[model samples]
Target: MKSDMAQEEDEPSGAVLDQPQEISFRRALLDRISPLISSTYTLRPFPSKWQVIRHKLEQLRSYLAAAGDSPSDSQLMELLQSVTYTAAEAQALASRCADESYTGGKLLLRSNLDVVSAKLDFHLKRLEEFYAAGILTLARAIVVSRPPAGASREDMRFYVKDLVSRVKIGDSQLRLRALGALNEALLEDEKYARILSMEVANGVASLVTLLESESRDVQEEAARAVDSVARFDSHKAALVTAGAVAPLIRLLEKPGTSMEAKERAARALKKLTENSDNAWSVSAHGGVPTLLSICSEESGTSELVHAACGVLRSLSGVEEIKRYMVEKGAVVVFVKLAGAREEAAQVQGIELLLRVACDDEQSTAVREGVLRALVRVLDTGSPKAKEMALRAIENLCAASPSVAMLDHLVVSGFLDRALLLLRGGEVCVQEAVLKAVSRLGGMSEVVKKAMGDSGFIPELVRLLEVRSLQVREMAAETLAGMISVHKNRKRFVKEEENLNRLLRLLNPEEKSATKKFLVAALVILTDSTSVRRRIAASGYINHLEKLAETDVTDAKKVIKKLSSANRFRSLLTGIWNS
Candidate 1:
């Protein structure tokens, strides 16, 4: 009877205590956030992860009871969050969020007021919706709240680090986004100087190690993230010391990765050693010789060549690096890329060779040798390479004037080969040869006549109607050069419609090179007094003046040069004498 009476007495008070009041879940969780955010700020006695989860469950049960038999809408949401994060790092989270002032007597937490106060829909149904999508707001919630000194050697740091590691690589986009966030937070100059942490370095190393992952995006992000982390000298040295260069170079050999990734890595490598031992290490790792082999491949990979050239370009700038490049067969590589059929490869290859060749004898040999090869390449390569090679030759000629290069190619019958191929070759190669011939400085009238005799005008005219911008540029340039020489100059003006077709491309519809070519061709029409009279008589000069007024062709230079007494006398003096 006494036990029953005591139980009856306790039941009344228990019922009153169990009759939950309406406490908001946000108020409870947000109130605790300061301690949570600050919890990992210092090393602490970490509870077992399960203990943290169990403590959080107890807190949720009590908080839910206080709100009512069930939680208020806000309290319910906090309870669900507790479930997600308690198993993650509950006590450390609370401690990280808590203020230093709280240790004396209070348990107040520092909330990321921005996150806490933001009105979020945390209903179970909405939470589940986000959870199903793997976008639990709490997971995103922890990102911004992280202390700027994000990684440390403490146990909580290890635990949090493990959490990130446990995040599956299956979600590439999310993983990349997470990497961005981590880089933004942990990769800081201050972090490097004062924080006394290699944790960031470890994180970066993990990212760089992913370069070998079969996943292209992972390799890309890994390279990008590695580039970002290499801002510090020590980290850069560590990465180089750790043999990261070879793997990055190997990734460049992968044909599938984006050019952006390859270039980014190339640039990073250049920056890392800043002309130190890493440049030579690239070769020691078989990087240079491998790059040389890649350059020799003619499979039409423009982007890959550009990327490979970028690595070479950087290596060519410093004396020590340049020497390393030379020793590693860079000369042979550039010589080959200069002769490649891909436009970008030829363009960048020439640019790369120009840099390497601009200074010393060895460099000059590579540059001149490549130039000689390109002269022949202009005859034999695909239309794209021929055009690109011509442009590159213009640049190369400015850097290293070598007519012997062209003379040799000519002696080898390269001009005839190019012209022969033009008539039967793809309109591209035909056009390329024409543009190339325009720039082929040391040419004889016999060669020019051979080109004109190859039925080049009709084919060029046919190509003028072709839609390719580069093709038209090449055709226009070829016709211009053909008209500049005495033997073929008359052939151009005799084709009445040729003037009209060249004029259209000479208009605003054309590219700059096309206009230059048209202007060159137009200047031929007024070469002599009789030709000028015929031009003046046939309305061709007036048409040119109108075109001069059109301004698209920059023909004023040609008109001004042609009409001047000096220019007229100089021109009608012989070449345009017809």
Candidate 2:
């Protein structure tokens, strides 16, 4: 951090701080005025004003220590010179006031004292501004350098500290370079991110302030660094505490800001809002509308749209913000995003749609549009995308089971797509499909029968044998909904294996929570005499007897129904034998 002041003494006055000779001259001037202000001859005449001026001069002398080595801005050196000469003038005037042979009048002397005091006060304030801008600290800051390869933690710590300081006070080019290096260091490892965010003073704040830099390069680099730091969960709280949200939203809102900068800002915001408090911070800063606008812009790059929608998706977790997003036409944005060619954008949009679809019912066109996009996702998207799309469809139809919407779902082949997904999709996708089936199936008997006829019942029945208890429970729940339609009940009862599986699940030894829904499905079937006769004859009736004794959810009622059917069967057999 050595200063670069030159030895040349002949440079112009504008470049005086660069010349060691001028620094020495400024020092000598301060020294000569020091004794004049220190003496009682001056202080006794104007005690209060002299005290103030002397203190200001002392502060000015402190600046000389750094100014002697550092190449301060020209303005700073000029002010220093002005104050030093003013202090000398104040000393001469005080001397005139002190001496009885002085020719100047008393009022004139008092006025001179007032003028000098005002000048010192004004100079002190300007010096304070310089310090506040970190000019003095910048002067003393170590020279910026790249960290050595395989640097030790201590070495890295020093490097990161220097970078943060430079970012806080460096010139435009220096700040840009420092920010670029800082961004690289942060991304290279979380350790540097930790040091910058928690250990280095004002480190996060420095990055945040640069979000508003006049230089587009500086803004971009700062955003990159903030985005990197924000990716680590441990650093997010510090960023929010440092007020990163508002500037981030401003960057997104700023017109004609380069997409590169906006993308990084949006990404940092996405990470920040993962924490609920940070989401509220963004919402409080009016970030939701900004995010929605980004999502709505058709010309936005896929990555940009994906990142912006990602922010809104995170924000949707908050109930209050979720409603607010709905009011602001986030649904329209989400539906548009859901149709994007990019898989990531579609996933983000669908995820948010799943959260808020139930609250949005005014736009049937939007719902259908979202439904069509979801179907497209189911058809071509990756497994995760398919899962999110299924959930969104489930929520959309469940929220508003209008005949038209349900008809749209059916007419658009939602059931067919779901059936295919259930057959071959990943376990997660299948699970989401089961939920969708349960919701949509319960909405319409036509949908239920359509699902039953499409072999959904068979797939659900087979899912009962799968290992995930949740899947089995959802399967049973969906089947229970399907069987409420008389045709579905008959279709389910026609499979003796389905009945046997249900009977096997009823075993008290089976601890699956699916038993309740299985029991409910069986109760729906017991209305049929043949189905009851088949269940009574099954070997797994022992499980039913145990469940009946425990009165496990409609178990006794199932037994009573089976008992009545048994009596009828015996009478029929006896009559036939006679």
Candidate 3:
């Protein structure tokens, strides 16, 4: 009969005899004892089947302990699978599994308790191994990880203190590693950078000390860290206070320094100079000569050239630094870099050149090569480069001391390019081009004729209605400059739109200088009798008469010119009669 039952159990559909008779009989006995197990405990009710399953598991455990052997893996899994446990139940089971004395006792079972204990031990060991492996992997990941996103301020402060302490002590190798980590942390978020800048006491000074280290690796990493931290304007003062300027300059001047260190130091200096006060500080520490040397160095790397140009550009905004750079022959070096193959070097070099060229004392220092570079930048450079180049050209042309440079620009198709940019460029470009045209127009009648013939009059008339007040004012000034020539006056009078746009500027809200230019342009345009009649009919004569009461001398002059013109008086008399 037992052999027959075993054969039945092997059949696919034999659910009734799927397990050995002893195991099935044991489960049936537990099923009967399940309610008794639940009644013995005082707690809230569990699901009906869950109560029975828990009781059965408990009874099984007791039976295993009484027998002193371990159950098979499949048997244990099958018993536990009878019902799902809640989170609370799982926690309780985990706690129970953690106990080393959890041996079954005082219950009957088919299997030996010793086998059950060994099997449980094997499964528990596997679980503990997995848990430990996960923990170790997580720790390794955290050790190398950047701060979590949106890390709290306290967390950032702690991170800064830890890294700063590490950077302050230990062997050179360890400190270098710490600085690398610190730089990584600072670059991870702008918030963390701010925390490092403000929270950690003497943090910046510590990094500054590392800038003078004998180890190149240490110096480079320290520079990179300062560069990252210096991005925030608030920290720049701290860096300067820490005496970083002299060491950074030394890095730039040191012949043996690697290109990477030089480049990073230059960039850090550039960031520090974002504040105007820090800029003067950099110059005071002899940074100008160092930076100019970097720019002039033939063997300098492209990055070093670019960064040095950037720092010089910032410093050039200060009048004292401008004179210093010019005295050190920075103009010639900048002119060379403005034409470099690297676009960053070209852009920054051009900007630096522009700032230097703004001073009248530097005009004689600017050579023909520099003019050609400005023309080249204006012709093919980026929009920003073009804007800056046009500004430099305007400054050169407008400076009383740079008449020779102005003549060179006019003869080299510079005015023609200015007209093109004025026609199709952005508003800023248009403003710059107008300033250049105005300056070049004043240079000589030949250039004025060239500007008038470039169809510049109509473009200037269109700009009068542009939204930007500066463009409108510059356009007015440029037109006034051109209208001194008879042909430009005729052209200005021919555009009724231009006449009306000028009439609109008679509103009291227009600035005094803009009003002056508009009035000057109108006075010249009214030399034509027809335009005078149109201006009179537009009632702008009355507007000009009212403006004459103000401190505007040009307004008074325009009133005198309009009143002296017979055609304008007749048109006004006719309009008054009508």
Candidate 4:
């Protein structure tokens, strides 16, 4: 009775005569149809293809999860294979959809594909607007995974040439994508960048046009691409000649631009201004005032401030631009940035101010404020920052009016930090520190005393043996300056090692300037009875007498002083008799 009832039910439903067989037939039909749905479904227009394909993938994932034991391993592999192929196709379509000439069919089919490609680009941008993070991630992953190894020089040139052409005529969305691709390729490898810069004709001109795009993404990406290409000195003049300066200045001046965009534009301007002609072009396009405005923008970001300061630092090398920057309150902005928490801004700001202070006309205007800012940087900034700070200090101290500011530097621990740097800082930092010390030590008694109290004498003495001739010369000159003060002379003469180092530098092979300072320092040290006796006993008088025969007036004077010193008269006569 049960078998008859089951057969009745199955016969009504299908050819199967049993429930299990009926279920098996339905599963087989589903397995065969799943691939078709996953592969050939193009129901939606190109604009909505991504969404339709995404939905198809999600359905496939769900069907795989629900399959349990119904579908064979082969069927599962086939379904997954279709999903993989479709995903690859979707990615390829997204990238190529922006290509207006991409046609995948015969005459009629080609027309249809072109229309679909245009629609796809339009809708892809819209989709990106809604799901920007996801799309960007996918795009970045695709771009990063594809290395530029297979891209020959000609291929890169053509690629950039095509993109530049598209950038001119394509929609805003396409232009942005093309510019973005250009930027990516430029950044990926220096070879591609060099090829684009040297081989492609309109690459830079198109980037300049993209810099003026209303889209900030296009503007920022274009500026960054310009920055990368400008790294090659060969391309700098080309970039500047392509009208990059005017738009870059405009982007920097535009209030509505993002800080990142302004930052990139400022960096590009900095690079462009590396050529003097480009600097003149920038000034002609009102770049200095715009950069000054950015420097003074209180709400500007650290990156923006840093980039602006860098541009100003470069432009300030031009005397005319420098005077303009100073007249426009560049000093005030630099003072503020030098004290900011941003290390890069602090470094660049100090560097720009240093340039300004190097000019005789502008040095007085920023001397006091620059001194204070440099002290702050030397206290808490990085090694590079410290080096810049010390250089600025040296420049500021070069002005006669800034002499009184030495006490402020000393009170702020400038002497202490400088001494520490001389001992263990980087080579650049050490050189800067030595310069600052030498300049300040020559200016005032208070600075000399502070330096002496900081144990700088020993450090200076040790520097006499340093490998750099400049360092050795600076050390000797500083010592001569210190001993000019009577109190410092007493202190220096009391240190046996200091006197020994000074005498050692009197070797005939030593530099003439070094020998002159050494002689001057020894002249003061010999004012002490004990130092006079020590020098007479050491027989350095013979070397000093030989040096006196030359044009070294100080050496001649020292010989007379040593011969006349009552404490050394008998020892000197005994040596002369021998």
Best by TM-score: 2
**Predicted candidate 4 versus true structure: per-residue lDDT over 207-279, tens digit per residue:** 8878878888777778888888888787787787788888888988787787788888887777777677677
Please provide, for model 1 over 1-578, each residue's C-alpha lDDT reduced to its tens digit, 9 standing for 90 to 100. Answer: 57732443344321322113223333445455434434434433223332333323332322222221322233234334544354234454444434333443323332322222221213323433433443322222223233444455342343324324322221455566655544454454335312212442234455666777677766777777667656566667667655688778777677786666775676566566565566677766667766666567665255555556656665566676677777776666777766665557766666666666555455445656766766666555656666665566555655554555444445645555665666577765655566556666335455556667656676677766666778777777667667767767667667766666665554444335566666666666556545554444444455456667877355675567446755656777788776
- Give the lDDT of residue 182 in candidate 2: 78
What shift in Å separates residue 147 of candidate 1 from its native position after superposition? 17
| Residue-wise C-alpha lDDT for candidate 2, range 1-578, written one tens digit per residue | 43433323233544535456445666687577556645633345667666556545544543443332555556666676677678778768766756733566667777887888788778767865775665444443335465766877655765676676556545787677777777777777788998788766567998899899888888899889889988899889999899999999999999967899999999999898887778888899999899899888877788788788778878888888888888898877877777677778878878877677666534787677767878888887878788888877887787888899898888898888888888887889889998888878777888888887788888888889898888889888998889899988878777778888888877788678888888888888889878877776788777877998887768888888888877877899999999
User: Candidate 4: where are CA atoms >4 Å away?
Assistant: 1-159, 184-206, 232-242, 253-260, 284-286, 289-305, 363-365, 399-431, 440-477, 493-520, 527-530, 534-578
My TM-score estimates for the predictions, one after another, are 0.46, 0.65, 0.54, 0.57
Off by over 4 Å in 1: 1-37, 40-160, 163-201, 205-243, 246-310, 334-365, 375-386, 412-414, 417-435, 440-484, 487-578
Candidate 3 per-residue lDDT over residues 106-225, each given as its tens digit: 132112333333444443344234223331011111132345888766456555655664565335766776788888887878776776666555678888998889999999999898
TM-score of 1: 0.46
Identify the superior model by lDDT, candidate 1 or candidate 2.
Answer: 2
For model 4 the local lDDT of residue 423 reads 90
**Candidate 1 residue-pair clash tally:** 22
Whole-model lDDT per candidate: 0.54, 0.77, 0.67, 0.66
Candidate 2 deviant stretches above 4 angstroms: 1-18, 25-78, 81-121, 124-171, 177-214, 224-260, 268-303, 311-333, 340-343, 504-508, 567-578
